[model samples]
Target: MTATPVLVLLDHAADGTLRPPVRELLTLARELAGDAGVQGVWAGDEDVAAAVPALAAQGVTTVHRLATDTDVHLSAVLADGLEAALAASGAALVLLVSSFENKEAAARLAVRTGAGVVTDVDGLEVQAGRVVAHKTVLAGTWTTRCAVSAPTAVVTVKANSVVAQDAAAPSSPQVVDLPVEVRASSTRVRLVERTELAGSGRPDLGSAHVVVVGGRGTEGDFSAVEELADVLGGAVGATRVATDEGWIGHDAQIGQTGVTVSPRLYVGAGVSGAVHHRGGMQASGTIVAVNSDPDAPIFEIADFGVVGDLFAVLPQAAAELRRLQG
Candidate 1:
């Protein structure tokens, strides 16, 4: 019996290097493919050859590369090339990282291939020649198992669900040039301007294993919280009230109205733990709360609770961590 190949839709940086999420996707793909082989396809305007080393290190043996214009929207064209590769490779399953761009592209590919699409897949396994996906739904209230019975299944996996491991021995992946046809719709949307966010030298909130978050109790001073996060090598997040008061950037807000996170460890300082905020981070592996109020709402869900001023607790915690590291 011949095993069908598993296809990976690659995402690369402007420098043509594979992004961390893409690396994580390839790692999961390798596991799901089992005895089956793994192949990849990337279509963009960057230097495709630059991504070869990282792909090879991740055990992707064959790659389909296509070059397109950077200024024009290439999702439509990318989907076309990807579907063609899927047909050519006889792939039964396609894996994509659940990013905004990939989500849109996966939807387009699903329509073209007539394949059942599943998004927010955090885990996957193959049983009896079927793919089972694990998804977090209903604002982290439920864990749902889904299976795509279609001949070809398209799945979008969330970032940071799995740790990426490098292949013991790297292979020089065979690169193939793919035929690209830029339809009128593909070029209709054009990028007019580009703005880059300043780097914070911390992992992305969506993927960080540890997160240190602040709330109204922060009193508009996040210095201690930021230092603690830096010491832990994690990202800093804030509650909606903290952002509303202009203490932290809205991008760092974590609540029903902001971004959702499910890190391995969540540290809440001076947080009252409103249901809205808990909705975003309640799925974390372990939660710790530091608040002055003994009856704070956050203490109800916290695995560990400390009743003390955050300004006093955070600095001491940071100092202790630094001493231990030293």
Candidate 2:
């Protein structure tokens, strides 16, 4: 009997590249069921020809390509692809990186395919010859193990939450073209005007080597934090309270309920370091805390820490960094 396929829904960036999470997803699938084959599904405007080996680096054996129409919202389109692919692939599992868009598509796919949908999955293991997926819930304070008894299951994982295992490089990835079909009634919202958030000037949060984050304590003066981030060539993040107070937009929040990040280094300033705050950041390679209180919980997770006011510490750090560069 042939082994069932474990397919990853690979999201293509504007640059026609596969993001890191898809690689991680392949790693997870390989570990969860070793004999099973790993594969990728993508819909993009640019050709995905160059991205095959990048997937092979993580154990992908095949790539399924569908032409993308930039005018349509991807989530709605993704649901259509997911329904068709899963129907034909003899797949036991369909994996997605648990972004907001992925979650939206997963919900629609689950209803359409009658498959169980699990979100925020961080680990996968086989127990009793069945896959058990691990997920964090309730602001990362609780853990749960979920198993799908159906013929198919859809699991969406938090970014960087799962550890990626290395796979022996496969032979050249097999690329197969797919003819995507869409129904008019299936489409809900039409794409109109799209706008990019301009001039935050921060580095890309997903792959940044360094990160600096502020919180409610920033009190609308993020200039110092921004300066420090600039010197370090890092990205800027904020707490939920910071975004709520209007100092930063909703995009900067990092926590269980927001974006998860795992940078090489992370710096937290004036953040109280709630569990929700730690949920998104505990995976960082190194951490530093800048707070006036010695007992702040963030200090507990820090590789280096200073008990000083961020208003004073940030500017001083930025100034010294700038001066040294000059």
- Which lDDT tens digits does candidate 1 get at residues 27-120? 8888777666689987666777888888889888888776444332356766767777887778888888776667787888888878888997
User: Best by lDDT, which number?
Assistant: 1
TM-score, prediction 2: 0.80
TM-score of each: 0.89, 0.80
Q: After superposition, how far is residue 117 of candidate 2 from its true place, in Å?
A: 1.3
Clashing pairs in 2: none
Which pairs clash inside model 1?
A: none
Candidate 2: count of backbone clashes, pairs at least 3 residues apart or interchain: 0
> What TM-score number comes out for model 1?
0.89
Model 2 ranges off by over 4 Å: 68-74, 163-166, 196-203, 206-210, 223-234, 244-246, 262-266, 274-288, 293-306, 311-326
Per-residue CA lDDT of model 2 for 115-171, tens digit only, reads 888887877766665667887665445778988765668888755665666687564
- CA lDDT of each candidate? 0.82, 0.77
Q: TM-score: which candidate is best?
A: 1
